[model samples]
Target: MSTLPVLNNADMYHHYSDVQFRDGCSVIHEMLKPKRGESILDLGCGTGRLTMQLASLVGDSGRVVGVDPDSCRIAVANEQLKKMDDIPVTFQLGSIREALPLGPFDGIFSNYVFHWFERAERAEMMHQMYDSLKPGGRLTFVLETNQPQPNAIIRDIFRLTEPNLDEESASGMKMDVPSVWLQHCSDAGFLVELSEVFRTEKAGPNLDAILQFLKASIPNFQPIKLTDDGLHELDSRYKTGNGDEVAFSLTVLKVLARKPQES
Candidate 1:
């Protein structure tokens, strides 16, 4: 989930995120094991779904800050925050590339986010995350691994449809391998606790639905504006007789690492 500061429709994206992604992140949360009274940062906490969950896990005494670059999603997150007065949850519009919300947090958690930062800046970003954490604080994140090759349909869509996107920008969307990311954590002086890759398939009602999900969630695709007719044509051309439903596989990497306590 790259930070789209100007999302086309935050509400629609939030809806699909809840339907497809929220449940899968439960395992990442378990790996985090946030405790009572701990202050945590939910990096790229789109619409605050998992951030709110972290608030519950950390309990009433704990504080959780959900930060994202998109003001639209942050607005949605704040709207939801009104109902959660009893919980110490806050939503902020910010980019990790700019600065994290004030923190020497006990833990930092992100989902499918780190890879979205500029490739050249990633090492510095990792170091910044490290600097924001308290001694012995943990950093846990899960992201889709870079496929050996981009999906043909998606690649074609970007290459053909997105007039504003260039070759380099499209290539930047690919995530790094698990080993490279694990090395990032190690380079940042984190004690690597876990690093593993897993696969999951996401199903949708139709190709159109899946495309909408991607358009809503992916920053690079924000420039793409397709009408109902266009989507129907897409479905007709690429659906491969899968009936009205579509499923796609994701190669995901989960990493948990901790800052060493002061000597």
Candidate 2:
């Protein structure tokens, strides 16, 4: 796979996580239900915020391993680890496609991460997660749903400025609906525990932040750089009102699946 769009922009991503994705932690915490003395893996753990949180739940006897594909993010994660001397959390630079050899974990926790996997690789990812877990290990996560409204809004806004941009190439992210995810889990030998779809809103980014996110996180949008005047125009057109924060709506999918014990 080509390099991730956020590979070199860890600081911006850390900021994005804090402001936009932090609120999802409550749902993740409730779903994962990590136990003390349990081994957990934080897959796609960008900058290790959630990983540290998991470590706290697991306590001194347990350990949490955080893995991500981006080196810069991993570096940031390691830096954060310095302040977490009591938490048994470690960050590794790796991709999910590797089927991570560090395994037999009691639980796996990911937040807004699975959708980053390519659609074609998702089944394999499910299998890998299954293999990485001990029997009855749980995989819990929340990610953007495969609903079209969000993507459509992005495409529509970009098209206003660049009419030539194609729909298929506008986004690098691959989100899927719950049914599709359930099928993958079943195929990988997981017993589905819970699946829910929900909606949430985040403060819409301004043009400067939007441009940074697109350039740093959206591969398809990277090549289509917006001019200064065009960006200002799009911001004027899309932003809600003067001095008001724009509302960005997202449909989210939450799942808790477990590897079935040997019969």
Candidate 2 residue-wise lDDT, 18-39, digit = tens = 5435654775568888889999
How high is the lDDT of residue 261 in model 1? 97
List the lowest-lDDT window of 10 residues for candidate 1: 148-157
What TM-score number comes out for model 1?
0.83
lDDT per prediction? 0.74, 0.72
TM-score of each model, paired residue for residue:
0.83, 0.85
- Which lDDT tens digits does candidate 1 get at residues 1-263? 22423555788888777444554366546689999999999888888888888888888889988888888899999999897767899887886544354788999998877766766777787888899899999999888776544234455455555647764375356477888888888998999998778765556667767667767876556424666566665666556456777545567788889999999
Query: How far off is residue 167 in model 2, in Å?
Result: 4.2
RMSD score of candidate 1 (Å): 3.7
Task: Give the Å shift of residue 71 in candidate 1.
Answer: 1.0
Among these predictions, the greatest TM-score belongs to: 2
Give the winner by lDDT: 1
